[model samples]
Target: MPIRLATTADLPAISAIYAFARTQMAKDNNPTQWGKSHPPLDLLKADITAKHLYVIEEAGNIGGVFAFILGEDPTYQQIDGAWLNDQPYGTIHRIAGNGKIKGTFSKALAFCEQLEPNIRIDTHQNNKRMQHLLEKNGFTYCGIILTEEQAPRLAYQK
Candidate 1:
């Protein structure tokens, strides 16, 4: 699979991937993280227009999507726990797979790492799968950070 910036043409596939991810989360007992309409079409469109959205393509189809923003995230400004470092970092958000391919997170992480060694991510406390993946990938628990919606999420850095 190859990762590349997403364009408007990828919206339908991206939306489908998120929908599948939401269902998977529900089955995994982590329903509320994305709820029913997270990463809404408008937000995803904004990400694409902003050039922050990327898609993993396999066999000419999109298998995964994610947002890689290289800058400080307002939600990460205040944390109940400290970060690994104060250095410049990238934030990975809205990562989801369409179930056709595995290792989406690992592939995304590797791609992001090539750009910035320091990366930050946050997940809902109930998202055990995400937490495990983060831990397994050498990410350390940083602390709790509230999302823009004021929902608390477990933060991590690597």
Candidate 2:
């Protein structure tokens, strides 16, 4: 699968993927992470406009979407646990995949690594699947970081 920068044309498919992901998360016991609408349309549009959104395409179909922003994330400014390093890193956010695809996380991580070796991510405490994937991919649990909403997330870095 090849990852490409998302365009406004990709909005519909991206929205669908996220919608499915939200349902899946709820079923997986992580309902509150995204709630009804995690990554709002306007924010996703902003991500696309900023060239920070990417999608995994397979056979002309979009299977996954994510935001890879290179730089510090304001939410990560403070942590109850220390980061692995102080090196410049990229943050992976709003990563979601349609249930039809496997290895979406691995593929996305590889793509981000090509741009920057150090990567940071966060997940709601109940997001066990994501926690497992991140740990399996060598992402160390850095600590608790609060979202803009003041909700604490489990932060990880690689």
Candidate 3:
């Protein structure tokens, strides 16, 4: 799988993944990080237009996506616990996998590894699957952070 910068044309595929994620988030009883209004096609277009989203493609199909930003994340500054890293880090938000697509996490993880050594990701406190995945992939528990919506998230860093 190869991860590439997303384009406006990828909105439909990305939204599909988010739909599945919505169900998972609901099942986990976590606050909707993306909210019901997210992936508004227009929002995705803007993310693509600004080059903030990346997609994983395998066999010419969109398999996974993760929104990320370079440099220190403002949210990190407000961590409720000590972060694993005191250095600069990249922050990954809204990572989702198309349940119909295989190798999703593998692809996204590979993409993250290629970006930088210092990477941080957070998941809703109820998102046990994601937290486990992050730990399995070498990220250490960092702290909790409240998103823009004021939802608490368990943070991890590598």
Which ten-residue region of model 2 has the weakest summed lDDT?
A: 29-38
Candidates in descending lDDT order? 2, 1, 3
36-141 per-residue lDDT for model 2 (tens digits): 9889999999999999999999899999999999999999999999999999999999999998999999999999999999999999999999999999999999
Candidate 3, residues 16-51: lDDT per residue as tens digits? 888888876777775466566555677677778878
After superposition, which runs of candidate 2 have C-alpha atoms over 4 Å from their true positions? none
Q: What is the TM-score of each candidate against the true structure?
A: 0.99, 0.99, 0.88
Clashing pairs in 3: none
Q: RMSD in Å for candidate 2, one decimal?
A: 0.5
Cα lDDT for residue 74, model 1? 97
lDDT of 1 by residue, 36-145 (tens): 99988999989999999999999999999999999999999999999999999999999999998989999999999999999999999999999999999999999999
TM-score of model 1 vs. true structure: 0.99
Off by over 4 Å in 3: 39-42
RMSD of each: 0.6, 0.5, 1.9
The Cα local distance difference test for each model comes to 0.96, 0.97, 0.79
